[model samples]
Target: MEFASRYLLRPSRICFPLLLLLAAAAAAAAAVAVPPVAQQEQDRIGRLPGQPHVDFAQYAGYVTVNASAGRALFYWLVEAPASAQPAPLVLWLNGGPGCSSVAYGASEELGPFRIHSDGMTLYLNPHAWNRVANVLFLDSPAGVGFSYTNTSSDLITSGDHRTAVDAYNFLVNWFERFPQYKQREFYIAGESYAGHYVPQLSQLVYEKNIGIQNPAINFKGFLVGNAVTDDYHDYVGTFEYWWTHGLISDSTYRILRIHCDNEVSEHPSGACMQALETADAEMGNIDPYSIYTLPCNDTGSLRRNLRGHYPWMSRAYDPCTERYSKMYYNHPEVQKALHANTTGIPYLWDTCSDTVGNNWGDAPKSMLPIYQELISAGLKIWVFSGDTDSVVPLTATRYSIDALKLKTVKNWYPWYDHGKVGGWSQIYGGLTLVTVTGAGHEVPLHRPRQALILFRHFLKNKPMPES
Candidate 1:
């Protein structure tokens, strides 16, 4: 998954009179004084082209984390429908370690709308998480998505620790920009590599709250799905999953076990790489994200030609949504609507960033220590896996959780949604593990209804319903 940033006019300059007029309109609409926080941060405002009419107020803009270095992170905040009342804030991140949460999380997954195949319009997501929480999707680490830094070194080198610190800074400043939500309950949720991001950022938030008489941000628990936790278990479980699912040959699996076992280094050895290549060859051209789903064979040219017409909308699940996202985000009108690509970034918008992925500086072998620390602090923790995600399968999550050595508070049981088995769940001493049946790497994208049920349960701090 490789992503490129887009280039468009920066929206930093606006006349004072226009700003005053906009503030007056906002204040009158909400029937409240327009605070400075709202005035300063609400510079970028416009309805997305072809977006459906909605009652919720949506915003997109940048939060400067480092002024001297020209570093800023892009964010899209989709507030819950006004009728739902003020909702808790949930920061949604997508994994890739370098992916665009706006493109994936907001546009494709649990956001308010899904991009139509025509790449020029949108459709309402009936089960968007914003229905339950104010969802904030961020493109992080200064180089991912619309986030950027004038310092080239910053983009070429990023790691877990720096990312956590920067994210904390972003939140603190973001709160300053949106004072209304400063004291609101906050929860972090993400998938894939965000297994590292969510826990790491939560730990920072928890540590910063210590000894403070009153913390501005009411930090709460976190939830991750198909997350990458431990390297050893992840690799072992992945190989085992491939073999068991008949995606790899026995000999290839055996070779991977011997060569890549416990190979958690940031850079694998030549032998391990060779073994992985062999395994991938056996896996073929199937969609690794959702093994059972069809892969998108549409080329760039084909996508461009389907500009204004409904390209292809599947009656069921469409695995080709990623292709549509790329098309949608790259459209000049769409970028202008979202106030993205404002700096005229040199590349086209992409789902995942190649620069960030390739330059990822540090990846801890395991996040178990941080998990243990957070769990001991009495924070709510929930881990979910989409059973069909071969990249980080349920087996991998099970193995990682097993390493925690926590007592099972409840025996495993099937959880129901729509009067049918949605998945299975088990409660541990400090955490809960859940599985979304027939889902893949991106749980919400694969099982929107079930994912919403899982999210609602997580927010309520309750177990999934069993019938």
Candidate 2:
């Protein structure tokens, strides 16, 4: 099946109304900027059609944040509804540390519509996320997606720290443009590499809040799904999951069990070899049965199941064809706004540099430093998982949490509503972790109802329901 087909299910009737209410409220209540700024803001707001533009209203617009990066990069903002109260603004970031949020999350996963192959048209995803809160999908770090930088070197070397800084600056600037949202309980949410993005950014916000002693940042919480939080366990889980699912041969499992070491980072170590031997043996019959585990040929498996592998990409939208280009690149207004040539870059914009010859030569490794910084500052931190995901497996997330040694209640009982295994929640210390059954990398997309429940609990600053 094509990539989009795997995740391109019709939106959920159950969750669509909530998203619409939030989006509508936010748009209606938003105070358009005044003066010259007012005119532009009004015009941009005007672009938001009153009714039935598509599945959801498409307000293709950009925010210019004042950043140390010098030039203001372009970012598209799509609001569900305008609310008078300045509804909680959820900043959605898509990972790859290099992908476009609009193309992936909005167009494919939780946005209002699916871009037809022609791209000019759209189909509504009933399950679009805007129903919950005012969702702002961002292309960050100045180089990825619609956001960009003129300097070539900047494009070649964007790292985690730079990403966090740019994103933090972007939030500050975005709030400035629409100041009403400044105190609207902000959240940093994303998936995949975002495992890295959300936590680091949260740490910065937490630290800044402490400095002013006034909680200026107001970073309420962060949500990441199928995140790559720790490199060590994530990699190990790949092979271990493969073995458990019967995708690798018995002999291969033996090898992996014998040599599996979680910390070797050079070219695949002896442990990795053991894992690979098992993966190699069971490559062909692995699938269908092995859909839940990481495949033997990671690269090849991804290519074969690109759509399924990456839940964010539009299974339907073609980045090249005229229809697709026009919707994005050729949109006369978007073209003018971007200040780019009539024919902009072909592929969808990725926020970070995915340029050739650009490698993150092991500079420094410190996940704990950032985690400690956030904890020391008292930021509301949340880490959730799709119980079934092998990419950033629940086991790995569990291991990471164990190290935290936060106070715990041994909270691991099933939560049911209308009598089915809805999901489960656990609260240890101030931090929280919940696992949604049957969800994969993108929890929100896969398990919207449960994900929404989780998010709502976070917004309310309440512990997840104890069932």
Name the best candidate (by TM-score). Answer: 1
CA lDDT of every candidate: 0.78, 0.55
- Which pairs, if any, clash in model 1? 3-352
TM-score of each: 0.87, 0.73
Model 2 lDDT vs. the true structure? Answer: 0.55
Q: Worst ten-residue run, lDDT, model 1?
A: 2-11
Question: Per-residue lDDT for 339-391 in model 2, tens only?
Answer: 32213333332223344113332223335556666666566777787766544
Q: Model 1: per-residue lDDT, tens digit, 1-467?
A: 11010100011111111122232223223333445477445644468888889888888876767766667788899998888767899998876667779878888789999988788788899889999899999988777776766666676687888888889999998888888898798999999888889999999999999998779889988999999898889888888998999999999889778877754345466777777777778888766777776556633444444323322222435666877787887787776677666533334667766666666777788899999999999999999999887887889899999999999999899999868899999999999999998788888888899999999999988999997
RMSD of each: 8.0, 9.7
